[model samples]
Target: MQLTAIGINHDTAPVALRERVAFQFEQIKPALALFKEAWSGKRSLSAPEAAILSTCNRTELYCATEAQSSREQAVSWLSQYHGIRTEELAPHVYALPQSEAVRHAFRVASGLDSMVLGETQIVGQMKDAVRTASEAGALGTYLNQLFQRTFAVAKEVRSTTEIGAQSVSMAAAAVRLAQRIFDKIANQRVLFIGAGEMIELCATHFAAQHPRELVVANRTAERGMRLAERFNGRAIPLSELPSRMHEFDIIVSCTASTLPIIGLGAVERAVKARRHRPIFMVDLAVPRDIEPEAGQLEDVFLYTVDDLGAIVREGNASRQAAVAQAEAIIETRVQNFMQWLDARSIVPVIRHMHTQADMLRRAEVERAQKMLARGDDPAAVLEALSQSLTNKLIHPPTYALTSAPANERYLLKEIVGRWYSPR
Candidate 1:
């Protein structure tokens, strides 16, 4: 079987495309089931082992299959599932096989492949995706082993290297950019949407700046209150945003909602209510919590996840050496994984060999039992059985060695020698 990684990421596609291709957290289970059903039907066998890793920056499908051409099939399935044309989607897709796939998985887990270099959030996101896949019954030995090693390599890299130092996360970048706009975060009123990890991080950073007032709005009031209380902020229902948005100078949103929650009309109304005061906004969601049109407003400084790329790159120069170390470690791990894959390939051959030997032994034992039943001498029967078993065990190699061509005989000799006395 071959290991394949097929997908597109922030490097290859714009957020406009990335958001369109992204699978919502709730959509993953059913999508995986559909993929498996289609894959098994197309291949005329059970579905190949598969897992999907989708985030704001990337969407990837990893598979282990005997059919090398499954890459194309996967792309087709993705396009069909998302209702996009294959031609439009194929341009940004990358299909990595074997060692390249292994390398990519390791790099991703290590945060070498994130928009924010060495960001630790991707690790949790990957684990969550894997858990969903496992619940969906999409994982098998190959993908399970691949992810386990990917996690181990990530842990080693983080502990032994400085890849995460001086790293500016999206949340930190948002705070920095807001500082540029507001001069003093202590004077600003901050509003956070959703209670996810991103929102929590952003809240922590902004709270440290001593914002005058902080508020968290979420679909679930209980969850929102929990996160809000952590930073000494108040909680509000998402439905109240239209009325309450004008009160905050800084708005940060990251949610799993498939559609935009903050629209042009709502932001326009909020800007009007605030007497055209500047409102700095950061949207960390993939499909986007804020509308694109909101960015066009003069008083609304709306920045999407893609807009933070430049800010996140600010301190990356210092991480070059650490990236090199991480790469070296990843390369070694990739080679080890490939070696394991190679060993797995010969398992069927080993099984066949054992089966043949067992059959030969059973046949010899039955013949000796017949001889004993016919009143043959027990000592002679035992000796003949032992000699016959030994001869049968060595017959194939013995015959091939004696009948081999002169040039091939030396190669056979080495193999036969190893069989009797392994190195």
Candidate 2:
């Protein structure tokens, strides 16, 4: 079977497009099942293995199949699911086959390919995707081994290098940007627009400043309340955002909503209510929780995930040495993984050889049993069994040698000579 990965990410596509294709955690299991069914049915393939990794920055499909046609089928399925034209999505999609696919998976799981280098969250996200696929019965031996090694490489990367040290996280960068707008973070009120992990992290960083007030707004009141309680803040339903948005000076939002949660009109109303006070906003969502027009407003300072890329580049000099060391470790591991894959590719041939040998041995044992049961002398039966076994072992080689063409015989001699030569 061949391994393949096809998808788009932050580098290849805009947040708008990425969000359109993003698969929520709840949707993953069903999506994987559908993908497997589609590919299997279209290509006459059965039990094709597949896993999907969807995050704010990327959506990817990793699959193992016997034919290239399966890859094309998977691409069409992804385009159809997202309701986008195949050609439109094709440009942004990357297809890696065999060893390249294996390398890509390892790099991604190791955080070498993350939006924020060395970010640890992608590792967990990858594992969750694998678990979902396995439970759905879409994972097979090849994929299982591939993912297991990917996780192992990630762990080794984390333990052997300081790649994560001195790294500026999106949450920390959001706080830093807010401080630039407001003289004292402790004096400002902070509002988090979602209860997801990104929002929780942003809240943690901003809460360290002991902000005057902290509030969490979420579609689910229970989830909002849970996150709010952690920061000694209050929870508000998302419906109340428009009316109560002006109360906070800082807004950090990262939601899975398809549309912009905070539009230009909402921000305009909020700015007017705040008496034109500057509102610091960071949108970590792919589709963008805040509208682009909101950034054009006079008193609103808006920053998207792309905007924070520059800020997160700080203090990287100190980690350069660590990155080099980590890369070396990855390179060695990648080579070993390739060797394992090579061995896996020949497993069917190995199984066939063992089966053939078992058949020959069974046939010889049956003949020896019949001779002993016929009342022949035990010594004669043993001699006959030994002769039969020897003939069975040498017959094929002897026939091949005697019937071979001149060139074939020469090639056979060369092969046997090399086999018997000293290492």
Off by over 4 Å in 2: 69-71, 395-423
Report clash pairs, candidate 2. none
RMSD of each: 1.8, 2.7
Tens-digit lDDT track of model 1 for 147-214: 99999999999999999998999988999999999999999999999999889999999999999999
The lDDT leader among the candidates is 1
| Whole-model Cα lDDT of every candidate shown, in order | 0.93, 0.87
Estimate, for each residue in 1-423, the C-alpha lDDT of model 2 and write its tens digit.
888989999789887788888887788889988887777777677858899999887899999887763446666788899898988787888888887888888889877777678899999989999998988888998899999999999899999888897678889998889889999999999999989989998999999999999999999999999999999999999999999999999999999887898889999999999999999999999778899889999989999887886787674667778878877887888789889878987999889978877788888789888888888898988887788777887676678777999989988778767755899
Q: Per-prediction TM-score, please?
A: 0.96, 0.91
The CA-based lDDT of model 2 is what? 0.87
Worst 10 residues of 2 by lDDT: 66-75
Instruction: Give Cα distance to truth, residue 197, candidate 1, Å.
Output: 0.6
